[model samples]
Target: MRDTDLSVELCGIRLRTPFVLAAGVLGTTAALLERVARRGAGAVTAKSCSVRPRRGHPNPTVLPWEGGLINAVGLANPGAAAMVGILADARRRLAPLGVPLIASVFAEEAGGFGEVVRILEEAEPDLYEVNISCPNVAEELGMPFAADPVQAARATAAVRAATRRPVIVKLSPNVADICAVGRAVVDAGADALAAINTLGPGMLIDIRARTPVLANRMGGLSGPAVRPVAVRCVYELSRAVPVPIIGMGGVTTGEDAVEMIMAGATAVGVGSAFYQRGMGALEAMAAEMRAFMQEQGFGCVSEMRGLAHGA
Candidate 1:
């Protein structure tokens, strides 16, 4: 509110603020997407859909710990075909608000990435977030494309060929060198990047029940826990590639978002915070960011970006 500019351009898409609603957090429906947009999200990303429908893992798929939440939602979605209608509806609802809709997609194979993108093109989303790094579905989908530089590039290329829309390849933190995959995807024609989808296929147990907390037994860790890893990944990727980066993981506050921007993120992705707090989290984070910017004398998001990388 101090006239400090939060607007940032991501691959030609101008966001009113630096905070984007990360995919999979209340992104399954048009109403939910609209709600986040109304709540102050600069942009909204729909849940990751595939070429076909998925039942996803059963209940108890998400559990909260002292640090954060572990979830194995298994990318549950209505599939690409059905999602076209959902996305079109979301776009109509979002357009009036001047908020961009970013469609997220994932596939079990390289070519499948393109196939899904083509089908979803009917919805005309402003951007495509090619999710090649979802950690919760490794068993069903096999190793994530983000694990291998070659495979990451291949998936990125597939999505690139299918859409003229800017593509942001989501990366995983479970790899040896995240920068390797980052450079590969950029070389393969990705217009931008999003890093550290979630950390670990970590597990939790019910002490009394003597069973795993989540039915899937393993889930990706998110919330306050993964911010460090996310920041590091974004920092490395920002330096490794020339495109814009959407940094996310456990960003729960405006200070956290600012830390991410200083870490070299063009935009900050907000996910688990919505769960930890509520819809108000976005507004709170935005206020906090503005307060920090005003206090620091930073005029815009671009000025704070990569300050950690020093000249």
Candidate 2:
């Protein structure tokens, strides 16, 4: 496996490998963030941040599906100011690991998103990911940011204008033509794209109560069930845009990671599966990927990228 090189670059940031800890899940605390870095994640994206702290939607926010998970965590966070403190501490702890940290911020509007980016720009994260696909908030008012290419472009442009740091636009799977939206963001100045921020404004129903399983009644669906769709999105967007892609959705193993890379994702994010396993899973998955690459006679992970495409 030493013959296989997993190094990859995203938005000018060099990663030891292509595995990244997805924005949600065990990414909320400094301790967890450090653990993920030590476990071998090339980079880490914090749980989505808002302008102020939120208690979230209250309990029953997540439900298990056959192959994925449904969650309406409501972008719950300690807010940007407090999040800066949290990130500072995490950075100090992770300094020795040399892992890149990508701050993930969400807002109700384009201006709000830009404000968060400008504020966090001082913290000097390796990159910033503008979360335009959060589905649990009411401010969305029936429309998701990533649902429309025009709106997505505006948001990307606003954030890009606000900061000099590399910006990654995380897209939603709830759109009709994801590639079109991706292209718009790229044209608007997105340095890269993280395709598929969960699938669906999905829901779970409780048979006994004859009611929705979540307090919010609707949540984003993730896990193995959305892998195919996520892969397809990566494939389509990679072909439509010139920017790099970070593909994620129900990736549980190294093979899953390689599949996304072949589908045109320059990197992959591990979400729900981390909840089922543990942070150590990141290292294990990387090891497995190295083994697979060696077996396939591939010298570098980037060489396998977009192999499924005609190029």
Candidate 3:
């Protein structure tokens, strides 16, 4: 019989496992999302979508680094209306796999975010991830939303009021006190918090051309290099807020996911690793997690949560 103990509950939704595909990467398309679900992710969050379609940044949007990838994909998407149709199809396909889909959405302002949330609310997504940070995008509103606690609170509160679904605020790691911002959002009614979106305003320069590697000049940093910071953010925010936390940064293995969970994340999101290992990576990681659990004699992932804190 299958080990049913891998299940985890996030934002009021039950997942078959604690593994979830982070927004962006291969999760943008319905076919790719279905492929990821079949490969064994407990849930999948679509690439961040906005009210209007965005072409995203120009080529050389992603650059490889020592332990991760720096990307300025600029939140490229076909807009919310088109995304709803795509999500509906993906949901139907995922039903057989019993994997939940969380829709990630972003907007330029509180009003815009509310409208986007309201529009997508009818799509019946398992959850809604309010992206308050996107370093690659050329918008003045994205990161600014979470730069301060008051703004973060207002934006999250607006989205919360617009939908009955769970609202998860995806934070930017570039902030000084992420916990303060996290607390604001949670108080604003966010059902959960997704910390450490990407670390940056970071840039890489080509020594030969003496120019920035990415056309956008600067992008969000993600991967193994940022894992430590991700852990700290998750740990601090988990203590400051009562909502569940989804930790993500450089998680590439079951051990990495376990670290985040132990640091206080109920679930973990994998992105750069997916690009590095492809869709099959999800299954590989899940298998590793099962083995780790069995070896440790833990029956469920919940039992492993925040063990670092002696909880």
Top TM-score model? 1
Alpha-carbon error at 40 in model 3, in Å?
A: 1.1
Off by over 4 Å in 2: 138-141
Worst 10 residues of 3 by lDDT: 135-144
Clashing pairs in 1: none
- Scored by lDDT, the top model is 1
Error of 2 at 303 (Å): 0.8
Residue-by-residue lDDT tens digits, candidate 1, 10-37 = 9998999988999989999999999999
Clash list (residue pairs), candidate 2: 223-250
TM-score of 1: 0.98
Q: How many collisions per candidate? A: 0, 1, 1
Better-scoring candidate (TM-score), 1 or 3: 1
lDDT of 3: 0.86
**Candidate 3 lDDT, 1-311, residue by residue in tens:** 23528789987678887888888878788898999888878889988898899898898888898868998888889999999998998999998888998899888877788888888877788888998877766454445677788888888988898988888999988888998899889889999999878887789999999999998899889999999999999988888999899889999998899889999899988888877787788788888888888888888888888888873
